[model samples]
Target: MRLRSRLRGEFPRGWCHSAQWWITGIRDLTLNTTAAVATVVFVGEAKRALRHRDEPRTLARLSGTFEGYVASLLVNSGGLAVLVTMAIEEGLPVVLTALLAGWYLPNIAISATVFVVVARSRTRQPAAWAELDFVDQHAPKYGRPPETIEEYRAQQLRE
Candidate 1:
């Protein structure tokens, strides 16, 4: 049995051409789409780390650094992809391919630089994880665990 069924239908011929163009255009932006997705993932992880500071600061710091590296790579790659696409669409011929190569090479260099810089940077002074306490205090109904290990142990003993 086929894992998926292919649908067959007769549609306007113009629609096929339009669809092809649309797909090509979308394919052209693949780098940008990948970068954007990476950026979102990095930012989301960073936010999570920031909100749980008291829970192993080392892990939080590592996560934040990783997020920064990802963000930098995404931004640089996306920028390079945009430049290459513009060069191609403008019909730069052989120069277009050269420009694309130029853009990509520089992006690799930039990514390496950013990765090193982010890795060497210190964790935020206030730390994002510290913010968790405030949220826990304000959202009593959210079922936050006891703030301290002692408190947790005491609560467990009581039960």
Candidate 2:
């Protein structure tokens, strides 16, 4: 029968399609896990850096600003992705999906580039107490005041 021959021809293609889906799922899971671990490590390092109370307030402010920016970008990306998916399901033209992806991909790439620059700059920050004092003097204009190690410890104790 013609139907029997068609089914025979399609059986292997169906198995290949399932295999491709499985591989794609595994790749996504691996990438997600790696990203999660990297985020945890970065947070831990930032917290440790914050423990230096004598450091210029600018460093803290910068870190906070960078973190907030990253968070907002992530939220926006997620919301955009959801909206794109909804539009696709609603039978919107494929061109919309292409446009959305084109817009967000560049934004994400730019964010990542900025993050790298910040991380590198953070590493070069002065660790000396005298440097911190200088930072204190200069940072206030940017709303960053100098904090002393003792003051931070005392505040922690009160809590």
Candidate 3:
């Protein structure tokens, strides 16, 4: 009699469990994808800064965008907290929860450290607003900003 009743249920024999797994999986996937994109942008900006480290005013322009990166990292941390909470509340496997924490926790820490370095650099280099004004006047079209501030200044000099 028990077996017969189980078979007749709306979500027979673990189907409901499968549905919960899928929902959590989708949420995890979305969060990870967003984190990956933000990481790429942050890394790209770092590389650009390195490539022009010797040039005047480059740090200023780069610092202009680091705040955005820090903001996104904080938002990612909040999302991670919600994910961890969901995993615990929904009885998710321990390994999966551990993996998520292990992956993102250090990421948040390291990324914040990098932002701190960038912030310090901004303080040491204080010509950011002047470069910004240069950008405003020279790249007013917004479609064809120079690849680097050095390059833009050189182009402006030539013109």
Indicate which candidate wins on lDDT.
3
* Residue-level error in angstroms, candidate 2, position 141: 3.4
Q: Considering every candidate listed, which one attains the maximal TM-score?
A: 3
Ranked candidates (lDDT, high to low): 3, 2, 1
Q: Please give the TM-score that candidate 2 achieves against the real structure.
A: 0.36
lDDT of each structure?
Answer: 0.45, 0.47, 0.55
Give one digit per residue, the lDDT tens place, for model 2 in 1-159. 267533442343344556654675566555444333233324433444445433444344432345543653585477568867788688667787777666665555544544554555456655543444443333312122224454354344323
| Sort order, TM-score high to low | 3, 2, 1
Q: Write the per-residue lDDT of candidate 1 for residues 47-99, one digit (tens) a residue.
A: 44445433444433333244445655767677677777867687557776676
TM-score, every prediction: 0.26, 0.36, 0.46
**99-124 in candidate 3: lDDT tens per residue?**
87776666576456556666665566
